[model samples]
Target chain A: MRGIFSDGPRTALTAFYWAFLLYLLLPLTLMMAMSFKDASFVAFPIGNWTLDWYGKVMQDKQFLDACLYSVMIAAASMVAATTLGTWIAMLIVAEGIRGRMIIFALACLPAVVPGMISAISLRIFISTIDMPTGTAAIILGHTVHAVPFVVVMALTRLRSMPGNLVDAARDLGADNVVAFFRVTLPYLGPALLGGMIFCVLLSIDDFVRTFFLGGYRPTLPMLIFAKVQGGMSPEINAMATIVLVVTAAVGLYAEYMTRRARTR
Target chain B: MEPVVQFDQINKSYGKHVAVDNLNLSIEGGKFVTLLGPSGCGKSTSLRMLGGFETPTSGRILLSGKDVTRVPPNKRNVNIVFQDYALFPHMNVAKNIAFGLELKGLDNQRIHRRVSELLELVQLQDYAHRLPAELSGGQRQRVALMRALAPDPDVLLLDEPLSALDAKLRQQMQIELKAIQEKTGKTFMFVTHDQEEALTMSDTIVVMNKGRIEQMGDPDTLYGRPGSVFVANFIGETNLLRSTVLGVEGDTASLNWNGITITANQGGLTPKPGEHLYVVLRPESIHCSVTEPATGNRIKGKIRQRVFKGNHTSLSVDVGDGTLLNALVHPSDVAQLSGEDIWVGWKAETSTVIPDRQAHN
Candidate 1:
């Protein structure tokens, strides 16, 4: 059994998989290397490694303020997206709402349609109403991209729920409200949590939408974009590496959670 | 006493296709009744309606003389043990059983006592701390049963609850379930496609076909004297031959089979002369012999095949024109057959007459 599980052919395939991983992570690896450069500019090879860039990043007030604004926007969007996504998923899947296929298609549009289109539309709408396009507008725009993921994940979990679990709960003297909390909510916890994590990851790194809607103040991603425009510096590389590391951790955890939930 | 559940003229339809058509049934309290049928025959639908998971398109359902047709499942007096158990995946066995009691807002001590008693009833006392996924299939089934029984609901509706188990475990649980039903004295409204399961556990068996009740009776009455061709075919293995009615004499009818006329009882049914008729004979009722039988409808035919069952040998004799007369002879008696050709016979009292006065699509 062990031989059949990971034979020579399978080991070869695993090698290929690691190669693909290397291809994906090569740019981030370069950025991490450049972050420790003693040189003023972010580039490849040589030079002495130092923490001076990290020191500069820590002391930059504007960059730190942008980081705070990005955190606020991402946190607010994560909460809103998770709540709406979970409830809307339940409404479509469990509530037996009519026209479900249409609703499902519509719910998935924000995810499938181009993010640039959504950003442009949201920016237009906000400016048309004379609303400020700084943190609030950026948060709204990011939610549009993040919510579709949450909705899809929650719906996937809810759809695979055993048919009679809710029925059994009700039969056991639980009303619909209690049944949801007792049976359905427990099954949905991992999926909803994964969805929230994805939302956080996407919101924190979101560049397209935040670029469009950041009126006077810049988010972390917008600040990184401005730094790149001014030519790559060690401080910019340091900040990018930090963001990359956090997002990668979140993304991996979310993947693991959703997969485990599915298997169970 | 009022019936525990009464479905009056219930009809359920999915789009244009009827699921349960004009179903009327009343289940007595403290009796184990099974709704047995083929797939898509509305047995599960009927059970669902009683459990309030399904609302009939028309008609009312009364629980203990109180109408509950439009009530949600939680408000109804019944609970269900689903086919796959439907045990809460997250909760341990004890918590699963206590859920209903918790919903009723019972004190913790009372809930624990009720859960413990239910576990004991299901003979799963040691499995209280195990989650549903941790237990085996039969153990999961017991936990599911205990969960439904915890609240002591008036009616316990089980929809093919033993279907997920292996054959041996299913048989074991059948006896266990019947014993539990008797001990609790709760109305057990079970639904299953397995006739043997229904016969083993039910005090009353309601056989359904094509979204309608074909026959409802005790196992003895249903197997010994099936009312219609559908019921006779569904309940057990039986030889059904379409025949031409020669005439009717009292409660018995004479039908012409493959070049012979046989008399069969109408089984308390009266039909018009110009109607379709069928002869229903259980395989065991037909006795095979090398020599001619002393009396009754005896036909000579050559043996086509022999199935050597452990307890008995089943032989099918071809009586010409594509008609095969099957007989289940005892293993000891099968040795006495002398040649390929033999006599297949049954008493007139054993043959059942299924008459259809109206044509059906």
Candidate 2:
């Protein structure tokens, strides 16, 4: 018993780190437990345990449709953000020092501001332009908001690479396009996957932005919010548990990809 | 034949700091030429311009009698072996060598053959499937060389390619590089700061100083007849004697070194009387003796220190007036000499006079 905790010195920083982790996880753990309770309402101490809510969520058309829309939006956002972000990162890093500073500042404006204000501003801009609000609009919003993260990730990886690798590629008879695809892109694989996973998560879990930008077709989080208006229900817990499982699966896949890219 | 590469007054600058200034240099065809200089002397900058990795701020570049000043690196017919052996960390040895061939749109069979041939050329045929990270430093260097060479470029530029090797391995690679140059007979443009490596490998040496070419000649000519005090000091160990020129004869310059009259070969540098100059003498050329009976170019001093080298002995003599003379003599000669008075002398043909320039400071 002593040997297990004795491995670490139990310093203040380590204690604080575990404490913050517990604070983040306790609420989610309680929600997951309530999903399995066979009660009419949600509670921590359960008299009966069953998977009735989870079974009901699977058959509910509204919940299934919301889940389908969320998956589509998140997938679309992942592709768009990762592609555009990688290109922008390369362009910014290759620019002169002053140019890099200005461009980076402009790109990070959304991230520095509060998400609600940015989302509402984006909604106003879109409505003013007469563009329809739908899953596509939500995907666009998520992509714009997630681009800064992807750019930062790609920039970090590109910066860590040896400066002469690109030059060496050109010297070996590869043109600019070929050199980038062959040398630069390979090094950015792990970073791109990481950015892509984060974008997927952001698009799925985003609530305020989806409420402002999404059209008649609602996403899973919007549906969950609507269901929670009256009171807490086990069906909401069921949907949350499903989303959690999906997120964990995607995260595991991303970890596998990052490890594979690192080996090559 | 036209020279393989030419830089016509090429100038490269970063903002206000000029990296290369009006560099007018031409590399002759099918010769091993070395651009020898210390770091920040613009040798690497000149090489980079030739490789088209960096554009000249002004002036033009030519290759095969055609202007290629604005051409990108891949569009040029030259390849460079980078200093740190920039092999793609993700590729195997075979793939690395085949990179250029594939870029040229060659078919798979041809690329495979070319990769195999280059692997055998660099003697790494057994390690074709191994990645660059798995190879040793010297092995990776050879892979970089073979990868650049597989393109069959007109000129191969190497930027300090052997600097990352151990001393003995560096020496071995120097001989192999020279042998490869001979076998292929490509116009090789090499860069290095090690004077001994330059002398050992280059058929023509271009000594650079502060963004300008100081001297260009064969190794023997560059060593024996340096044009300026900088060249003389940069190429090898030398004993510099400050003197005022009394006058110039046809091929000989007469100077007074602290009231001791000395005549040396001018080597085409003409200086008028009462002008400051320097007499450049090699340490090995000056023989040391105990007695004062010397024939030519002799100086008297007391032996301050004696060092026994492998094949020669070096003596440090204080010849008064805060001037110290370094002389290399036979190792057997130090057996009979002690802290007594000695004489240092060299033949007239081995020493030359160069005009003194204070701008070097």
The chain A TM-scores for the candidates, taken one by one, are: 0.87, 0.89
Badly placed stretches (over 4 Å) of model 1 are: A1-26, A39-45, A59-64, A94-99, A112-117, A215-217, A226-231, B241-266, B269-279, B295-299, B319-323, B352-361
| Each prediction's whole-model lDDT (CA) | 0.86, 0.88
- How do the residues A61-165 of candidate 1 rate in per-residue lDDT, one tens digit apiece? 988998898888889999988888887788788565799888778877889778789889988999899999787888788777887888888888888789888
TM-score of 2: 0.90
DockQ, all candidates in order: 0.66, 0.60
Pairs in steric clash, model 2: none
Give per-residue CA lDDT, model 1, range B1-361, as digits (tens).
Answer: 8898998999999999999999999989999999999999999988898898889999999999999999999888788999888888888999998988898899999998888887877678898888788899988888888888888788998989888888999999999999989988889999999999989999999999989999899998899788887788888899887777777888778778766878777777664564567788999999998889999888889998999999998898998875887789898898887479899989878987776534454
Q: Using lDDT as the measure, which candidate wins?
A: 2
Backbone clashes for every candidate come to: 0, 0
Model 2, first chain, TM-score of: 0.89
Candidate 1 C-alpha RMSD relative to the actual structure: 4.5
